[model samples]
Target: MFYRYGRGDEPDLQPTKNWIRRVLLYGAYLDGTRYYYSPDVFLFFFSRLLEENPDSDIHQDTVPLPREHIQKRINADGDAMELAIRILACYSLGIRHKIDLTKQLSLQQEDGGWEIGYLCRTGKTGSRLVNRGYTIALAVNAVGALLTTRALSRNGILIDEGFVESNA
Candidate 1:
């Protein structure tokens, strides 16, 4: 949805803004701290939307996630994919902090892919682990986010120069 909007396509802004607000409001809590899933990805979209529509009512202040909260998560060894997302979010939001991009790079599997595991914690029940696929897709997004944020250099990942173009 955000990617489409970022590409200059028109998406209904109201619902997208509302949904982003809701996600920030009712997101998951880890280690007694709240975090939205795929935060960097969402931040990229949200920030792009705000940039494209400056007169829109949606403001960065309206976003519930704080820089400190995100920083704490980054410090806590959160999930690899989520961390990548957070890195992009931080970059988009102009929050500066040291994040070891190598950690995310190191998780790649021997087949040049990444695996996603579920940390399922149903209300009050103990968490269960489940391995899932579509790993290539997730890995691509993760890598893209890293590249977009410049966390990984050209030597680290072979990114096409035209992969992301500036709107300006």
Candidate 2:
């Protein structure tokens, strides 16, 4: 809290801040308890970014690690949920660096819904990610956020904070 409110960016603190900041910020993942591959994990992080100042210099380096999980790890129906989470995370962080939505949107089914992505692995067992409404609703919300971001950008508006907070 002192760092957040005080002049922590002063020259006196720069060296210590740089060295210890990553250890502190990523400590949760380093503990070997938090699985970065989980959508719920990333969603929790994204939720925190909701209140972040757009101009704050928060390190977003760890953010893209989840994308690799979506790309290489998730092959089952879990893609929809995980991919949406990745999108939401990027949106919240205001990264906006050539974010390609095609890969995610392509997962939409012919019935205009999303398959039930793995909520969590039960362990050592494969389960068919059933087509369900919960996943579909989340997908819809994610897509809506993406579309709003695009439209805002086209109109010369920057979602520097995020779609939800920026639009509000």
Candidate 3:
């Protein structure tokens, strides 16, 4: 029961936009992630820092989940990588201040590493990429970013506010 997610199956990823976004977004380095999606952030970080929740515009329930199912480690229901991206995005964007980081934290394996279920289908062969090392690195990085953000808020460095409801 192999799913062939050829280039046609995947949304037209600009050369490799989705992959790039997935990595940065999932890594929780949102300042860097913003640059990938919109460059204006480079010049004006504060303006883009407080943007309308990305979730407000794009609802996960509406977007059809990718059919390119390979092997999942934690949740068998949805895309693991996508879940990471969503959680990190909400936290980093200051869009969902109440977003529970524990949502992603709960998926941690006994080994204390996260497994990336599905990264993205390769444009040429459509082979989904899920690297154990890569997953662990990014997941740890995302968690670090989240913790750091919370610390900043506690220190009164960042305003703790959210524009939308929790996606976690």
The candidate scoring highest on lDDT is: 2
lDDT of 3 by residue, 21-109 (tens): 34333433322332222221221222122232223212132122111111111122333344455444444443333243455577788
> What is the total number of backbone clashes in candidate 2?
0
Q: After superposing candidate 1 on the true structure, give the runs of residues whose Cα lies further than 4 Å from its correct spot.
A: 1-60, 63-65, 95-98, 119-121, 124-131, 134-136, 148-168
Listed in order, each prediction's TM-score against the native is 0.46, 0.50, 0.45
Worst 10 residues of 3 by lDDT: 65-74
1-168 per-residue lDDT for model 1 (tens digits):
343355323456667666756655554333222322334434545555554554445654463354444555554465555555555555545553444345556777788766674334344454434444543455466566656545444456644432333321
Candidate 2 lDDT at 101 equals 49
Error of 1 at 164 (Å): 20
Q: What TM-score does candidate 3 reach?
A: 0.45
Local distance difference test, candidate 3: 0.42
Q: What are the lDDT scores of the predictions, listed in order?
A: 0.49, 0.51, 0.42
Model 2 residue runs over 4 Å out of place are 1-40, 43-78, 97-100, 122-131, 157-168
Find the candidate with the highest TM-score and give its number. 2
Model 1 has how many clashing residue pairs?
1
Candidate 1 yields a Cα-based lDDT of: 0.49
**Which pairs of residues clash in candidate 2, taking residues 3 or more apart in a chain or in different chains?**
none
What ranking emerges by lDDT with the best candidate at the front? 2, 1, 3
